[model samples]
Target chain A: MQGATVATYDFIFNGLGLREWCGESVRSGPMTMADLLARGAAPAEPQTGFDWGALWSLPFPSLDELHKACAEIPRSRDLTRSLEAGFLNVRESLRFVLDPMTQPLSWALENALHVAVNTPWWLMLMALLVVVWLAGRSAALVGLVAAVMGFLLFVDHYVFAMQTLSIIFVCAFLCVVMGVPVGIAMSRSNRFQRLMIPVLDMLQTLPTFVYLIPLIFLFSVTEPKLYGIAIILYAIVPVIRLTDLGIRLVDKEVIEAAEAFGMTRHQKLIRVQIPLALPNIMAGVNQTIMMSLAMVVIASLVSAPGLGVLVLRGIRNLELGVGLMAGLGIVLLAVILDRVTKAALARVNAAASVARH
Target chain B: MMDRQVSIAIRHLYKIFGANPVRALEHVRAGTGKDALMAQHRHVLGLRDINIDMRAGDITVVMGLSGSGKSTLIRHVNRLIEPTAGEILVNGENILEFGETRLRELRRKQMSMVFQHFALLPHRTVLDNIGLARSVRGERRADFERDALHWLARVGLGGQEGQYPHQLSGGMQQRVGIARALTSNAPIMLMDEAFSALDPLIRTDMQDLLLELQTELQKTIIFISHDLDEALKLADHLVILKDGSVVQQGEPQEILLKPNDPYIVDFISDINRARVLRVRSVMDRAPETIPQVAGTVDVDATLESVIALSGGDTALSYAVRNRDTTVGYLNMQSLVRALVPTQAPRHGNRKQEKAQPAASGPAA
Candidate 1:
């Protein structure tokens, strides 16, 4: 029975049924012997024993059954094709965001927002000092900040730098505040970790320019919060990823020891697990800050201020002096931020040690 | 003599890891055993039907190879791994019923454990690490440090307070671990193969230190080791486990004299029984009078020590005194008989023949 079914299937697949539907005229629909002579097709071999009745009267599936049987094949194939297309679309969108092809609207929006914020020169200098203070408490950091502020003042780009600093501070703070809990939640639940990991990976690898495209569609350049939102989206991924990693990497034995000591889950988390995991979390925070700084420069393309304007100015008019000084100021700010947060992390870990003792 | 003095009592405890622990445990209780349970669910019976008692001021050594559930057994005492079925009574109180706070309090005040690997907090100084248990109990820093320093000195780690665990030798690290446990002042100390990771020389030193400490503190101790020699040396009572079941449990001398089963006999076969055995094994009644001697050996000294003092003299004799009274004499014949090389039969027989003649006469 299986063999008979296979024969019918082969017949249908080879278009033998189409020939039958065309009717028995034309010598039973193109015999191998006649076709070989007429059209030089392959020569036919003689059959020793032919079961013509068995061949013709075999039970075969109806057209509806065939359609039903083969239906899932195309459906699965289409699903695979669509999935590939979706992945391509995602990749393309990310590429577009990272480095957009269209420059004029981006440039115009950047300039309009910059003019509207128009932060005062003194406020910008103060913001720079605050950035320096928050990042590092060292005299070296303070001195570096003072010198950069003085140079910014000397160059008359103080207002732009402060506008940039304010946006970065707010965005980075929001990222840490929001990302850490989400990361913790992700670490706690396997289902949540599985679901969030891919999304975080996509966010991390997505092009920065692609992020602006969605925001550009959602909010106009005139809004003060536009750059703020953009900066947060671009920089939030590092902290989320790092926080998840940190909590997951906490030693199982330590946690078990804490539990053995009769610590409540919350108490263990607060007193033992998190304290032990703090170094990694702080390292994550440091990465988040660095990433925020990196995005601040790109945020400048959208009218977010700071050293980015000097860079933009350098690019547009080929003014090397303005760009070089601003670049130096940004580096100084980055160093100050990196050092201060790291020092704070070190202090926290030290305090945790003291408490553990 | 009070049964109520039993510090920890574990009865038929079962720990099976799976979503269906009861079913797994029931399977075990029903004689399906570990293999059947593992077939249904990829679960292991880490501990199975474990019944034991750790008494006050006695060190019960749980001797087993790796995966025989020695560590698991110790962990269950503190409820680190909750037993599936059975009661764990610590000081007449079933700890299975202890809530988080009470359990924490029990761990803080009643029990302290030392791991084989010496699980010292890596980032903290020796002083801070030793003081951690006190701080966890909410003691003030100065008081905790003072106590930590005292305990550190007790463990022979004085003046090493400022150093980190990494700076210490393996033996010193374990000493710090002991000090940390001591600083907690917990009545029961669970030492899980505490000296198993140290060198032989260091291990012997640490064992001696533990014996000295135990003499003074009289802390209830549950020590785990796979080494029979170690168990024989330190344990007043010995519990041998195999495949998560108790093979034997008795006083060390009792186990050595007559092991309950061949498994235990094989386990302790390599042990130097004569060295580990007591004076009761080879004692002889005193003659009417024993000759006075300048030096006297303790009755508890091993035959090896007796041989060392006899100086290869076939006719040597010693005066054995208990306090002021001369209890007896130990003849060189007995000492030679005990210490003669067991492997060389000809030499052993020659020594035995030579010593028999000396035994017929008393010393001047």
Candidate 2:
């Protein structure tokens, strides 16, 4: 094993079947069929190789290495194939059980979206404007939102934007609903935190498209749930991390003080801890909503009708105006959501400080 | 105020703070010292075989330095910390065996504790924090608000009921803590360094106010303090601890006159002895022939007052009165002896609870 080096080609330049192709230049990149979708077609290779001096040589002197490789053969395909199979098994059996439990959320989101899209554009605009005005308590911010909505309407992207928005609102709502309790459980128990941290890490760092890929295989793209679950998994991380942090950050003295008063665990949590942690939780919700909007655009790849579909269509068809206009609509929605939530957060902070007083 | 009788008895209590304290306790029980337990066995001896009988309607102050387990002992009374081995009997029923529900019931209905930091719920208004015990017992806010308001007024924070804790100054915050405890109307009150967080002047005022309230309400109070001056002024029965063991405990005046431990001697060395010494500490039992008194001096009168009255006359003697009748006779020489801590450890002869004995002072 000490003098293990072999031919020059085998050591430094193995795994390349050809010397080079097109303008490849030996810099590895996306070379799949999807790359052809972005570009018109794969450029033809004009190279005829007379450079086979080092190309055909191969190393074949390692039985132990071959055995080690053979042992991993079953797990080699898909890299994490066993994990994939395990998750798929759970999804198949668990989906039916979960759908009943999660039906209310799906029902609520579906009804909400139905109302948001089916209502007259003017009435929807008025409702949103009123809500924004109430939250921000600033007529100027409301007017800015109205003007953005007005511009979106003139551009005829209002309905698509609204569709995108409704999806985000629902996903963000569900993220908070589920995330807060999980975060609380994490903060309350070290064992729960140890269990959740890796899963949360996967949810955060695993490719966003990978989340949709599994759902696509498990459920048809036609079912809203496929994208719904994908969006939730993609967007739920911030709220969970922040909510856990918020609870964990509460002053220890305050907790001891509460316990001393003979407040039961539930009473202490509700009456003391949560109110103090509200601002942090609100910030978490804000990040969740923003992330939800981001995922909504990506989710359109799987039959989720929204401004994201338009963005995808523009990408597919090379229509710059179409893509830019839809992207602009997403930006406007983001601004509105961000401002309203932030204003509400500031108000919560004020009230919290007052209570602290 | 009602005359105090024995209410809470903490007997053979041991608190060892460590994982596997039950196992480490064998070493502790087999004559291991606190240092040996910590350095050799990796266990902190929080309290060791502590015994104290807290009298009803009296301020039984427990004093110790930091890490002396004074706080630990006080917390044990409320069962905030489960003792490794011990008995805490509140009204003669062992609390060590209490289930969670019974313990909570004891906490909410029988005893209320005031904390060093006041322990006011920052989220609650003054009224709400004051009504916490009642609220814990499932009483509606309306049902307790009147009592809460009454205590608020009593503590001189009447109109501040609507205000939050942070709106008040530190002194005001502790007043609310007092009101919260008193409003609970629990028979026993435990105060752990309740005024230690206050400034010295505010501390004196707070102590005075506590004594004033105790005179009327006479609730059994178990107070924990590190300050010798505070203990001497406020304690009816003072228990001194060192390294989780009782060094000496009895009446503060008697303990001051005759410190049993060298540690206790060093502790009281810096105290203003004349200000703390009272006539009851120095006086002998009244002679069968009542003395020709210089004048009637209350048993509770500080030696400073006697010194001022007699103008350093060594020949004078006075009959020491408890309420209106003579129970003991005070001499100037005895007063001087009482002012100084004795060098020799007095063995098995200390009895200060006998002063107001045999005849109950005119019934309240």
Candidate 3:
């Protein structure tokens, strides 16, 4: 049966003129009586060599190789592989340009992680409560954060939670530092705004996993900045978009008033546009924090030390309790960050409302 | 008033609004009408050949219906809106030639504007809003704040300095706007429908306040308004606009007594003539000898006031006096005739609506 199959494939490949293109030695396998009979009967009917008869059985010899009659086209799998190879070819130059520019980010992430882990637990807890209080100024919020941190410490997951938070803090801060000016530039120039929209859309809609592939090639798996870059790329879109919208939404008559008063362009931007856009920028910051926290778990695949690493270990060892505990820790951390940022945003909204009223 | 030197002289100034304003301007200069130019070249004729010599220390009111470009003409004085072609000479220097810095200096030191909508900054305190012009010039806060506070008190908004604009009523907000203009210490005040957004009672109060301020400051003021009543009440020199072109311009009383164009006749036909016409406009110039008169009336007295003095007796005549010296005679017949407006042409409403300016206009 194996010999008969090989002979049939040889006949089809030869009939379609693709025998040499397929790169296979013709009929090298051992032959059986069925193969020998097929070969012997092949030249008996010379006029019927193309098989016009026998419609039900072997009506056409080259049916499997019909498209190969002209030329062999690259398949979908080949197209994807070649694209990756092409990207690899330019990786050296890209790394040369990007490595120096982004070196500081890796240092920042490493040092921030080291600090978060080495700090005394009591001091860290106190500092966390202080930050929450300053942002929210509400007793309820401060108590909530204190309770969640206490629970994490009780469960011995405090270090992992802090690692995740440290990563988020560094990445989200950088996002705001870079995103706001871009948003301002977008708001001020129509041409710049038109150019930036598609880029923002691509960043927003791209699958979360797809970007990680290129990022892995760009930096070492062990470097914290590999995930830092990943988190920043994933989280910067909202702040930029919201800031642009906020500035553009200022009342037209107010701008006219500013111009009528003979305000210089810089003076107007600082005194009028930025202040009015603050509430929106705050909201963007809130969104960026939430997004960065979500990205930290995915970032753990590249050896990021966090609660995500615990979850990955549980999955590998099939330890159900460990996985569940780490997952709960992440959820608690997310709630803590979300509430803190939201409370700050609410305060800004209140101040802005007072101005409007 | 006649001897006062011209503060802002707009000569052959034209503003066409479109992508190709300069090309459209050639058609306008060749006598193509506003509507025709719009239809043929898709350009709006904002102002056409506007020529006015605004005297220092006098209120020059540019009156027009909506779309008549009174606001456009006023903006040219400050170079807020660039003209397609023309020269605006402020104090004998062509302001059109001023570059960005010089133009800003002109707006900061020589011209200040009050808007129809009180465009006070919502985020700023009333005091900061009042000091906007000085603040933009990088003046020390302490230096401008004192002047801002003084004007604040003068405009009747004292002790409201700490409140944001949204915390105040519309009338009060506009008072802040007026004070802000005053704080700039600019010699030329441009009021672009400054009181049109207020209630009728508030509008009247604002008008009175502006006139009171004008009497004290004697600034070269260019006031734009659609209301004929406001124009006649405030204008020392009135320019009536029709379809982006001036139809008649002179003393408000003269424009009322001798309307040079049919459009002006139609415009003034609906006005309360008794309230606007003055005895000086209707009275005969000083004669060699005075005729017998029932009583004397001031040259500036409204014709309605003279009617009350004469008891509606057409046979009675009054001596027109200027500070107790007889200047002319006002017969009751001529006063009565002046009170009766000239009949407007029957088919003028369509043209009136088409000429309505986009900013706003008072009801006829």
Candidate 4:
């Protein structure tokens, strides 16, 4: 069968078989098999030749030679080892620095004290006045504030609203102070961005209850700062992420233009980049404040004083009236904060536009 | 050099990006050079051995396609990206060597830039956006506002100061950008395709505005654009870059008339030569005493304008005069020959896209 196959292959290669077949046909002139093949005749041997020696001896440098070529280079292994060492050192130093004894006395003291100053009840009334002013004209603002204040006064929940307001202020402030720089840093460096983004993603996706778990272990449950810190962490991610995103989103052309004008890196960041990124950052801040409000109520589980506590109190005691009033107060606070920040953002955008002109 | 004379001088700038930057820089310095450096770091050469001198009152347009290092080149002028090996002189002083305070001062006093996307602070009004640089430079709010208004008025955005950028049209936004740059009162302005983002019509209008502003202020502008037309229109001196190196640099007219490289010739292929070339450029000078005709076109007039004048037989034979003397006459034959597309030598004859012939109708 192999000899037949080789013979058929030779016949196809030389075109003798086709020519012989054609010669026997009547009323047809003798034609070469090459011509027949050229005219689309089938081939006998599709696989004609192979070089076994060339295939067996594919040229390659020796392993030692390759090693010599690669030596004295910055090896990936060395890089990996150094990186690991650096990270280990950083972690160790962080642990040492963050040791309980080494921590600032003031921070420890503040953490130890379970007391947080709740805003006076008058502040809630003040907030209502501002909210009224923003949502409506002066008369509407006054009327709304009066109605809310009168309702709270009648219900005797004014003090609880004030307490919620104060805690929200402290938590929101800390969120801003910490979140903005973290956002800026993330915006500035790709490595930092890569490192922080996953952390941020984890923070964002983790259940709000999960935050209390870590805090519960780190500090006493009765500490006021515990809830404050928890609320800040819970709400801070949005601002930080947004700040980074906003700054990154600032038109690259604009940054280039700023640099072309000979603006220093710092000047450009502070003057050009940050200002442009502010709207999104503020939006982030707005979202954070909203989130903080959402968490404030949950934080009431750990004695965070606010309308949250009142609502919790209402739920625990099954006081439908108390819960309803407290919920209403929280809504009022949320609206007030939202409106004010938005108004402030509007004002900022307007001023920036005007200055641009 | 006098204080006001020298604008910027860049000398032998090099930048190498790597984990071991110092080693890469040293290797570059040792003259195994750009190739070796790139080999070592697997880095793309952003700007290689760049040397440029920008003068006061001139618009030097850096024309290059994206990633040609035009942006990187401009960034180096301000020390935004530090050069690996180079010196940049601003007013004869090496600005790259300047400390932070001096650099900031130089930027605050001597330069301003307009971005392509009209980087108006979205959180601020037009007034505040223009006033930001002033505020950053520590100007009083009231003083800055007044100055900003003046700039707004200059850019024809006098009454729109209170509106947010979102409320304005793209053209108006760019005008605000121009105004923002102007508000700083810096002598040097860098515009990186500042009008590139706008629609074509608005871009033209903005270009006209820039020209008008240049006429008034002449602020040693360095504009970057990928569009050759924009570069030709606005630039006194044009630098055409390809592959992180300058392909050619010359006056726009020179580059247009006699392109130094095939790349530039290809770039300028579609330009209406009749429109771009002036009558003075192609016209042969005649004797001063030659008799002149009653109707003569200006030497500065483009061939397109001259062609439009050729309607009937009488209009066909118009005089091309230099000042008062009739230097030459532009007939239909010469005009047609000039208008006929010339094939570039390197790229074989490009068959022009033929206009579909209009079909005749029995009635109008």
Index of the highest-DockQ prediction? 3
Off by over 4 Å in 2: A1-75, A78-95, A98-105, A133-151, A353-357, B1-4, B284-295, B310-319, B326-334, B341-364
Q: For model 3, what is the error of residue A26's alpha carbon versus the real structure, in angstroms, after optimal superposition?
A: 13
What is the C-alpha local distance difference test score of candidate 4? 0.70
Model 2 lDDT tens row, A258-286: 66667788987888778877888999999
Q: Provide the TM-score of the second chain in candidate 2.
A: 0.89
Higher-ranked by TM-score: 2 or 3: 3
Worst 10 residues of 1 chain A by lDDT: A1-10
RMSD of each: 12.2, 9.7, 6.5, 21.0
* lDDT (0 to 1) per candidate: 0.72, 0.81, 0.84, 0.70
Candidate 2 or 3, higher DockQ? 3
- Report the CAPRI category for model 1: incorrect
Compose the digit string of candidate 3's lDDT tens values, residues B285-306.
8656677898889999998888
lDDT of 2 by residue, B254-303 (tens): 79877665567667777788898887777888566665679878988988
CA lDDT, candidate 1, residue A6: 26
**DockQ values per model:** 0.17, 0.29, 0.37, 0.21
